[model samples]
Target: KPSIAGKLDNIQGDIWSKGFPKYYETYYFFSIKTPLLNEKNLFSQCLKNLSTQSPRLISTLRMVREDHNRISTRRKEEAIKQGIPEKRVVLPEIPMSNALIAFTIKGLQAIQAGLQDDTSLRLTDVAATDPAFFAGMTPKEVTALLKDPDQDTWDPLFRSTEIHGMLKIGGSSKGKVEEHLKNIKGVLKHGTAIDDVFQDSPSTPTDSRVDGWTRPNDRGKEHFGFEDGISQPLMNGIDEQEPGTNANTDVNMYTDPRLLIVTGDTKRESSIPRPPWMENGSFLVFRKLEQNVKAFEDLTEQWEKKGCESKEHMGAKLMGRWKSGAPLAVVNFYTEDSKDPDKAKEMNNFIYENEVCPVSAHIRKTNLREDLTENDKDPRALRTKIIRNGIPYGTDYKGNENNTKLTRGLLFACYQAHIEDGFQNMQVNWSNDSTFRTGHPGQDPIIGQVAQKSRGVNGDLETFFNDKFGVRQSVKFQQLVTMKGGEYFFVPSIPAMSDDLGM
Candidate 1:
């Protein structure tokens, strides 16, 4: 049997290569009903349902396709020149399903109950479990085999890495959406006309957004300041083999490489031949990264008075993008005349003759036009592709009277192959590394960590300055973004679930 990675047609949309748009997320877990969906056609029916998707997910699918095709084209050119046959070519493509997220404990239970009526469910008895495959693998190896190393392995997957907990779902009105989910749970409750495999239910009342869900803690304003999700590596036609490792910096190998290429030469060695359930399985990670509103406000205000009038422009400089997603590395601060200023202009188009915006600004730091010239970093941002899917978790911004300040921040979710190498390492080693840009002092300025050795105004945060050049620097982060709780989850392919592990 071919490995699941070779089968893109069977996996869930958000589970593997495909990612949902940035929004609040939720995870749903369900159990099979006793009578279960008719095994005679269970697998076929499930796959059919997967073909149908929510509207938002469909748009993201198109973007993923474009990226996949782009990467495929590049890889094909490279492979042809290298003498590889066209038939053996591998190009990465997005997975079909977007992994599901459930917001509360009740949400998890609700999903479990829904499984009772889920015709896609199958009985454990007659499912295609293979003893030889089981014998070839241990519990640990089986778990690893279930996850593709090349696919994005952040948030949703992080949540699954835990023994228990529910996924948080997002949308316009989170509280209202949560209630709808609870209502579904009631419909599926046991013996009241519908069947229940996981529980009798009705004992647990539905949960509401009013109760409020707490956010995660591991985020901060990258040194430059504007909320940053600025750059990410897009998928292309690259082999699944380990890309050459960088030697100059220390790399947390496990965390950095968390993405899986569903359409390319991406491959992983399963202890045994892949099963149907395991095909095209991708991991998804969701996190609620809260940004400090007060801190950002104060910081931007201080910088604005210093001859920079556009707060949005300052954000672009700090985030590498205008609120509209345009890169400041291209357009100037005052030139609002450009018809829709959101699209990023090409590098050759930008006039860098004048250093009105310092060359070492946040955008310039991460993507120095020359791939090999500045800091010798690869110019291609594909290595850092992370599908950011999150939302502003707290209430709308209010004035000073609201001291508690809406528990505001970004629901920072990213999808990458390795956590340590992708987001964590990027923050610590790349973006935060003050020494990355040669001859430039301080950090990336936007996401760079301001440490004891950090370049702050006055002697560190130790001394006070009166009207001095350093004293003019009034911007500093007061409220900060933090990560609270999350886990790594593996979205198993249908074959891996049914035949390999019998999940």
Candidate 2:
């Protein structure tokens, strides 16, 4: 038997890889709408294509190993030139094209029913034990549970169509990703037709695909000008072996491997027994969030006019971090992010205390970070942990206050073993709940929703404009990040694809 880490190729790489080479990506959603006579044949052909291409899927373990070797070689070369041992080397950015495939519950049932010899068998016979996976993202009940806006407000493609599965294609450049997508489309052309395509930073008029990319030169920042993808949970087997040890070793940042991987030894005693096919599989939560930058800026300007705080300070208080990725709880001020490498590494180390970072701050609301003492005995933190692999969609706001035509936000995707306890719990139980920790801290200023008219008071956040000024005030923020559309998917292991799905 091999260690889980050794079987890297078995799992979908996007679930583990920080964010796939992410210069550009195309999330191709497809439906199995072939005629009954050709349904099985079409499904099999699509599965076969995926199985054959499984080897090309980027594996995080393999990626880490390759990066480690590359860094070591680079360090040796630098050391030789300097005539001394190299202490540090700037990490090289990997440029590569990759693809990941995941399916909705209906898609899995369709595939199983199409391929399985026994036509009498049902999805329950081979279910993964997650009720949410079966219920999906569009149901009125699920929408209400997630506290998302009305389904009617969502994009027609997501609200009306049955999205069976998605093929995520990403690479070093738009051209490279497009080339990869073309080849993929060509391969699956005989058996399948893409129902719709969602692109990152879509260029043309006909391309209705949502656009996303790392900001040019300013890689990690989103359209809101806030640094993103920081403070990720460090998994036991994966992050420990990765090149960077300084930040990964922090116990506060550590997350149980089972939270993101399907394993028998989960901390939840009441957890349902999962099928063998779900061994390395993980649940993927995909949300297309559209940000209203103009409205947010207008609100910030109004706050700045109050004379209690500057726009920069107010923004950091809301997000719990500066634009440079420095946590307000750690750096205590926005101007403290002075391009120091050592200071940058210390960003995720601090714990929430005395509301140094407001209790309702986006980061604090999403991750309590030692705010609850029960974390030592039975950790709620572990249950809600999710590995985010999202990217900013659209372009820079260009200070256009009235431009509704240019949409920009995040293609928010996260991986976790349990959907109910992870993403759903964070959004519903924590983010939306005003009195989450202690006191009426209000909803998460960034992602939290009011959910109902009764909860309207919870929508306004109370925070100090400046702790030094002692000018505490309540600010009612409009819904800035809108949930346009989304879906839940199951990224199955390679073995599952081959043996169980009949690839």
Candidate closest to the true structure, highest TM-score: 2
lDDT for each residue of candidate 1 in 161-226, tens digit (9 for 90 to 100):
222223334332344445534544443342332232223344643311112222323121222233
lDDT of 2 by residue, 343-462 (tens): 554566667667667888898888776744466743655567787888888877878447667788899988888787779889988888777767778778888875644344744333
Q: lDDT, candidate 1, residue 364?
A: 55
Q: Where's the lowest-lDDT run of ten residues in candidate 2? A: 243-252
Number of the top-ranking candidate, with lDDT as the measure: 2
User: Please, what is the TM-score per model?
Assistant: 0.51, 0.84
lDDT (CA) per prediction = 0.36, 0.67
lDDT of 2 at 350: 64
Identify the runs in model 2 with alpha carbons over 4 angstroms from their true place.
1-3, 34-41, 54-95, 117-122, 125-128, 190-209, 241-255, 261-271, 338-342, 376-379, 452-467
Per model, state how many residue pairs clash: 97, 4
